[model samples]
Target chain A: MERWIISFCIIAIEVWGAVYFFDIFMERKRKGWLDKGRYMILYLATVLVALLDMYQDTMVIKVLVAVLELMAFCAVFYKAELKQCIFFSMLNYSLLFLTDIFSLLIENILNSKDELYALENPFWLVPMKMVRVFLLIVLRWIWKGKNSYGALSYKEWRKFGMVPVFTFVSMLVMYFCYSGEKKVQAAYLFLSAGLIAMNFLVMVLMQDILEKGELLRESALTDQKKESQLSHYRDMQALYERQGRKMHDYKNQIRTIQVLLKEGDTQAAAGLAERLTESIFVEMSAVNTNHAVVNAVLNQKFHVARGQGISMIFRVGDMSGMRLDGEETVILLSNLLDNAIHECVKVAGLGRKAVINIKLVEEGGKLIFSVKNPVAKKVQVADSIVLDSGGGMHGVGLMNVKAVVDKYGGDFAISCDQEKFQAVVML
Target chain B: MKIAICDDREDDRGALKALLEAYGQDFEIREYGSGESLCKDMDYIRECGIVFLDINMDGMDGLEVARQIKSECPKVHIVLVTAYVNYALDGYKVKASRFLLKDDLEQTLQECMDDILREILQEERVMEFGFVEGNVRLKVDDIIYIETNKHKNVFYTQEQTFNIYKKMDELEEDLKEMGFVRIHQSFLINMKYIERISSYVMVLTTGKEISVPKSRYSEVKRQYTLFKGVE
Candidate 1:
């Protein structure tokens, strides 16, 4: 009865260490006593299987049942996807296997013979189990709050899962082939260390892949937004052309009225003049500049700003000397105005009338563009570029603007205070 | 100040003259019926501070007349007036300071005159300081930046640097309205000369780079952007 009780205590410690190890990377699904109760059930089942294996001497059945119980425990108590649960379960079980192998290797080095005899002796078994559990807890503490793998998708989890799965199978095979020979024991310790190193390498690689993927996705979204903005500007240009034709017709009608008044029909001439004036529709494309692209982009941004209840004031000088192509003009102006509008909307939300001031001028053979808007939060700028604090797509948009400015061998500067932010580009 | 209006139509010239008179500034106004007649008097063109030109003149069109005037007097502020919007692009080729549509001259004329007057004031404004060598007069627009070093303020321009015994705080107050910005404790820079800012460093058009402190970087950048927009 004493021996059975000792086995139960050792098994409880091992299961508890494994549960905490998996908890390092996985988030809990629910909180409170219900979650604790689920963990208790998992602990009890794992200990029961381990105790049964000790008496029955079936190592394969014991590891299989323990792995399934851990996986089921993760699915029930954690908020991870299926692949993530499976991957972490395999990783946890492999670490437990490694700790046991490490303790056995140490025992062999200390005794040099009678390894099976040591396994049956309570004095040896109790110390070995304590060492195994201590190693597990130490590892869990070192990786206490790290969740580097949390950002990855299920596909990535599946791909990276292979490493732990391979190590676990190899460990199982090594356990089955173990003979009390000194050569095999030495090989087992070296192989276990190699497997642990491999798992660490996989973690580093996963983090690198996550960062690169985020940047790639951001740039793709920026390009897509640019394309849509360009198309919308093109559509606005077509509308302006139609308006131009309508204005020409209105002019002809006015001339006809002038001729009618010259004749004896005064009432008809008055009626026609009044009707013509009433039919003339005034639209938002009132901005007229020397550059067609500038006019289009400004009008579109003006419409957007007005829709959001933000006022935009433009002081545009002659832009004929700007020397930029249509696409470059759209990219530069649209990005600047879009960012300004975004800041203005935030300011408007705070019960203040939001206003954006934009200026585009050609001075001394260079095109200067600037935008100023009120800011609700303090902005951070480094090396003259505004740093994105929220990790959003705003940073990517500014990067595109900077890229265009660099192409022209120009200058870009951003400045902000507690209540306002401004961006300026000279090309 | 001398203001000149050149147009082929008599009524159009009268319309511009009436608007100029309503501007409430004391000016000696001269009228030319054609572009050739305006270009004939070189002495009058040289002394004029601002010249208004009509683009669709009868002979030696406004653009050619503008090019000739710019070649002779590069400091003259040329205001180009046109009936159609297409001529504005051609006006830019001659380096016109402002563009006005004849259809809405009443609304745009006041703003144009305000800008031209402010620019002329900036061009004529000069400051005198007691330098270590002697007292020197310098154009406010020509100053690129000022660095405070060893209890002396050094003013850097395109041609030379002048050292004067003045505090930076006093100089910043005097030059703030004239497009100067205090980017650092030791540096007071002219916004017009700023080429770019990168990595906490402000690069001037004269190929000089000044490092900005991390604490003051954001405010400096914000002030620079606002200065560019206002200018």
Candidate 2:
């Protein structure tokens, strides 16, 4: 009964350790203790795995069952792709096998006893279990905050999944071949330790590569967005030039109207004047903020907003005090307005004419820039940080804005309610 | 409403006056040929609700006059009128409420006037509440947010907090049309004072932070966004 209790305790710790290991790397599908059903299933699975470990003498069969149970638990509990769940399950089982081997090797070295005898003795088993749990905890601590697992694609997972599959197969083969031996050698223990270390290094390197890839992709997308915005600005400039030509024609038309008035053709003069005024008013109203870059970005975004059936209102005040240069202004304003436009476009429907309000004003020696737009969904913010809703470039755009704001030693803030989202930057 | 139109050219001033009259609103219109003359009449500058200044005036340009008037009476809305759009940056520097192209005056003046009138009306709105001390009149714009504490609803403004025996639902119903948003059950915030809303918390212009419940977050945000767009 005592031995059964110890085995259950060891299995409980091992199951919990695996859960902790995967939990660090992957996001939970549902959080909090309120998820009692999933938690109950997980607990029952762990107990079943513990009972199987006691009844089953074959190490390979026991590990396989435990791994399958873990994979099942992960599938139900984690918000990850199928490939990721499988890879994490396999990797976790391999690590558990390695720690078990390490603990057995240590016990053998301390007692100089046969491996079977070390396994059967309660004195050896309890300390070995403690050592195994300790190693697992240390390994978990190393990967505590790294959660780049979700970013890995299926292809990447397949490539990285090879390491653990190889390790698991090799460890099982080694255990089967060497378990029949009288005593475990110290050299074999060193080999298993080296294998464990290699696994740790590979995972750390994989996470680093994944993070760097994500950064590269985000920056590349930002560059592409900037290129598109600049082209949009050029198109707006062409439109402005066309308007300038029209203005010249209006001048001639004015001259004609004045000539008509001089000729006492009052009716014809008024008719021409009315036509000119109407045509000019029908043209796109140019947003003229004396700052050339600000005017370009705002006008381009305004045109884009209008194209999407959304209205953009600008309430700009003294921009001379704004510390941003041409490039910074374009990045900051375009990203902000683009984010606003993106959100507004989502909710622009019948009876709801989405509107974006862009405000740039200098107050009390600080340049305050803000954008407000109607939100169709709830925005999650935790501890003042805006959490990305995922699946869109909105988060990346805001990050770029935040980067520019930070570069200028400015304050960037985001606030949202059920209907609206607002981003504010103070420089 | 008292309207001041300052332009160096008499023709532009007369044209603006004609447009103002055509709008059919009761406007006490005053015209100045130059920025200097407009600046000289401090009493008129202080009393007027809106000032239309021409940016290309000969002596003391519109931007300079706007800066002076803004310094003297910050409440007065200055609309900068310029033939060239390039002077818009300078207009922003003087904190002009609106910038109108001299060429597009006929098209934009009515819209500009409507916006200014709405703002002026919002600013002038006042409500009297029975406080613990007595009935006190409060400018609707001055109340930043209202918080329900126990049986009393506390009104927070920039200067002071007024504790009154009032229901939040009743106040929300009354102030619904006046730019006040019910962000939370306990908090009815004035949209004018909202600096930003982040992480389910509303931060005011005066740096007071109020927590917004997750369920009502999206609705509150939408209302705030609409309020800002209208403003």
Candidate 3:
């Protein structure tokens, strides 16, 4: 009866350790924890299975129960896509499975040496049980806070040394189980511990590399954005210089007109004025926002809107005090206005002429930017990018605006209904 | 009122003198044929209520003369007179009160002097703030931005920086009308000073780069756009 009680108590302790470690591994809180009743039910069931396995003395039942427990744990605790949850659960269970194998191997080694004498001795189980508890506690501590298991992509999770570590631990477990000599058992246990430690080190290294990769990707994206903005600025500069030359020519033409007037050639002066105005028609299209870059972008967008037969109402309030990188300003305005124009164009077929209203204003020390356009069809937010029925990567322009807005620590709000879509960015 | 007209060409100065005289305004008008002579007569330049400076001058340009006159007497209004309208933008950088094209000399000059006369009769738009040495008065137009460095609030202009002991919020209230924006915790930039902004960085007219916090970037950009847009 005492021996049965001792085994039952050990089963309870083992189940408790597994449940506690699972909570830490998944970064679940103890108080106000998710699905508390389910966890309790699972814990009771796991303990029952463990107790039954101990009585039946079957290794198959033990492994099967562990896998079932893992599935239940993942379902109740993990909030992620089914595939990602399963992947995370597999990682957690693999460690638990290896710990079980190590415990079983220690027991087998002792039993072989003393003809099942050590099995009867309660003291002989101390080292094996201690190792299990120590491994769990260390794992719980290492994965104490929220592990970013959900954030990682499938490729990242796979490439981050999970498969190799699992294989290495499995091979060590097999070797330890087979090597049952008295002296070799302790050595095998230490070797397995060393290998597990090395696996953890590799995990840390993989995480670091993953973070660095993400950083590099982000910087590269910014660089690409900067390049595009600069090209736009260059295009605008060329146009501006051309306009400047025309302005100079207009002055010289005025001088010619003055000379013609002095020579009593009023008809010739009138003809020159008409020709001069016609020649500078393109130059007259340029928006005067006081900032050259903004003026260029606005003019470009204006021409685009005009080409599409979309009525573009672009109003810019005092922006002289504002200075933004030519590239960034171009990217932000071009993308935003482009998106607005694209939406307006899509809905043009819906009987009404498309129109977009863009306002760049300041109030309360904040620059208020707002763009409004009628929606062509239903809008869907996919991958955090707002998309209309007129699909493709058309939403990329708005996404670029969002990226720039986010970088500048600005507020970007989008309000879309069946009829109208408005995006406001306040910096 | 004392008026100083500095032009490199004798004919241009004579034309300016004739125009100012035709306006029939009772004033003492001093003409400098070159920027060097205008800069040399510091006493007359200091005492003048308004200075009409020709931009293209030999032996020190009008911009340099204006800079020297500004440092000595910031209260004195400097009007940039040039043939090219394009040069008006450059004139604005130096805080020139008005840009008068030589072609419309009489009308532009009369308008500028009339505005100055009205301002003289009204309140001065100068903001006086306490600095390290003492209280210094600055024309609202001359200020580029006010920034916080450690504990000091540094006022940036086109030519110089003035360090003062003042809170950002307090200074903001006083300078908001003058088109100053607080871009970051440590930065209150004059919207006029912004030459370029991208990502988290803003380039001032002086070629100094200012880091903008991501959270306040849109705010800074919007404010700047509005300031530039309205005028």
For DockQ, the strongest prediction is 2
For residue B95, what is the lDDT in candidate 2? 78
Score candidate 1 by lDDT: 0.76
B110-158: candidate 1 lDDT, tens digit per residue: 7568767998898788999889979989999999999998899999888
What tens digits encode model 1's per-residue C-alpha lDDT throughout A58-82? 7767777778888888888887667
Q: Best to worst by lDDT, what's the order?
A: 1, 2, 3
Error at A406, model 2, angstroms: 2.6
Cα lDDT over the full model 3: 0.66
Give the per-residue lDDT digits (tens) of candidate 3, residues A1-427: 8666666566555656656655654544222334566446665777677666767755545655666666666665554445445554555555554565566546766566523223656644545556667876776556433454423555665665466446445644554365546666666556555555655565456556656655755676676577667758666776778778888988999999999999999999999987776556444545455777777777777667767776544345556766557776887777777778887888877776576656665544666677777888757643335744433233346666767777877656665678776677667
The digit string of per-residue lDDT tens for model 3 on B104-139 reads 564345545665676553334687878886888887
TM of each candidate vs. truth:
0.49, 0.53, 0.46
As for DockQ, the candidate ahead, 1 or 2, is 2
TM-score of chain B of 3: 0.54
Tell me what fraction of the real C-alpha contacts between chains A and B each candidate also makes.
Answer: 0.12, 0.14, 0.00
The residue-by-residue lDDT of candidate 2 on A1-427, one tens digit each, is 9877876667666766777777777877654353446545666778877766778898778878887888888887786667777888988888777877877776677666655335647756656666656766676666644564545555677778888988987787677667534334576688688878878887777767777867886787578567756765685677789689998998899999999999999999999997786567435445655566777777677667768877654567656556777767877887778778888778875346576766777655667778878788868753224665542233466666767766876567677789877777767
